[model samples]
Target: MTSAHPAPSNTVNAPGTLAAANEEFWSNSAETIFNEPWVLDFQAKMRAFLEKNIDWLGIVNDRTSATEGAEKKMLDYACGDGFLTRVYHPFFTKCIGIDIAAGMVKKYNEAAIELGLASEKMYAVKGDFSASVLELPKAEDVASTDLSRDEFFNFDFVGVALALHHMEDPETAIVKMVERLKSGGVFLAIDLLNSEGVSESKDEEGNGGNHHHHHQGGHSHGHGHGHSHGTTATGRSGPAGHTISHDHPAFSIELVKDMFDRAGLTDVDIIYSDWKLELPFVTDPGAKLLVARGRKQ
Candidate 1:
């Protein structure tokens, strides 16, 4: 098992600081707050969506055959626990899973090894995704790295799954990811959508209210005071609060589309939309997961 302590190789100061301070929250609490059982179910749903919605295999085959005589590379940006990495391993000649959290990288590596994916063809690396500093030896150097002309530039596809929302500025992050792709490369983003806001109302007597109203016909449930709203133990807001050390932002469909468009991408397509059943304590049935794809111009 990997130690919970911060790795010496971590280099992104801000995110690394957040990760150091909140490591326990991310590694341990996530399994509880996010609810592993629910995550398994969501993974099943996502797998089904991939199989029925996108022609992933066909696309891979086409891309692979097209590049038969050359090297092909794909990246699973912010790959957590190697879930999607394992799923999409067959497509690319090389699949590199990069993440800032050492814990995630450790687990991803372990999973790859256990799953017999430890070959040079597929692997995970501990690095800062925002700054793209995989070789830096310390977390503080992430910002100083010059990403404007990095050497690992050639890639056929970059998959960002549930990662954009974790960044402070998703628009900028998406644009940077798009910039890293080769011309005509594919960029896929799979994320969650907040199903608007729904609040509970009290009765005239100030007692537990029974006035049932539906928002878009979705089921309604009573809200409890113990439900911590918009605040984590660290006093920060958003999903970061649930974790021990990092703050991850969430994104919506329109917001993502606008960002992609601004990045000069084309052939944008929303390939999947399915309810991401919330972990037992994090959210309700209102949150929906969305998968969007676009080609680099």
Candidate 2:
């Protein structure tokens, strides 16, 4: 890992690609596109990425042993379908997930139960992670695990994936995620990089723009605001060969590194991974996703 701070010499304002309409669009899509076979395949790809890079067992065992078997906690900010939550459930003693979309939260809970995860192990709540603590849900009411909001902040690991671009203030979101981690805790984020500010949203067949489905599919360039069910593509194929499209805002590596530095994190590093999604008719060999990771001081 590199120890030096990133060169913030040529800072540029990240375009608010779908910041305004992302919430509404994603909320409507929660019920529709998230359940598509192709969308599910994309989510699997994301899970695979986490499984490859995240040492869940190592982190959990190390922390739990240090605390004399005290339960370790994990926070999934903007958790969406709780894809990462389910993966980390067995490793952490307590897992908490928060999302802006109620439908997505509902599905997260249902999926957790379907996976046979006990309620005490996983809890999904509908709320904006970017909101002030005063505006957050009652931590006690959010789950059976007895943890207060302040107590909830002391997490051993925090993961924010593919959801930062939709926020009105990505930097604030990063800062807040860092604030929630315990000392020496890890914070990891993976999302597209907007190096050239490319915001085009058209597939080969000229379907609707902004092809931002959850997990994996094709490259979408829009701010997804947590729309739930029905608005996303449901057909086998649209006017073209594939179905569904939504825009996703890409974050530049310089901007990502800057966010980590400002959040007071140490040992920050940027990694480029060959990320892609394979569907029945379409194989999206996606652009290099920027993974910004660090430890809280």
* Model 1 Cα lDDT, one tens digit per residue, 87-139: 66666667776666555656666767877864576766654444333334446
TM accuracy, model 1: 0.66
Clashes of 1: 9
lDDT of 2 by residue, 112-225 (tens): 788787877777765564422324345564532322467568888888876764555666678888888999988888765443311222222144322321121122334342
**Model 2 spans > 4 angstroms off:** 1-23, 56-68, 131-148, 195-248, 277-286
Clash-forming residue pairs, model 1: 10-138, 10-139, 11-138, 11-139, 22-244, 22-245, 25-244, 26-244, 165-249
- Residue-level lDDT for 31 in candidate 2: 71
The alpha-carbon deviation from the true structure for residue 47 of candidate 1, after best TM-score superposition, in angstroms, is 1.6
User: Which residue window of length 10 is worst by lDDT in model 1?
Assistant: 1-10
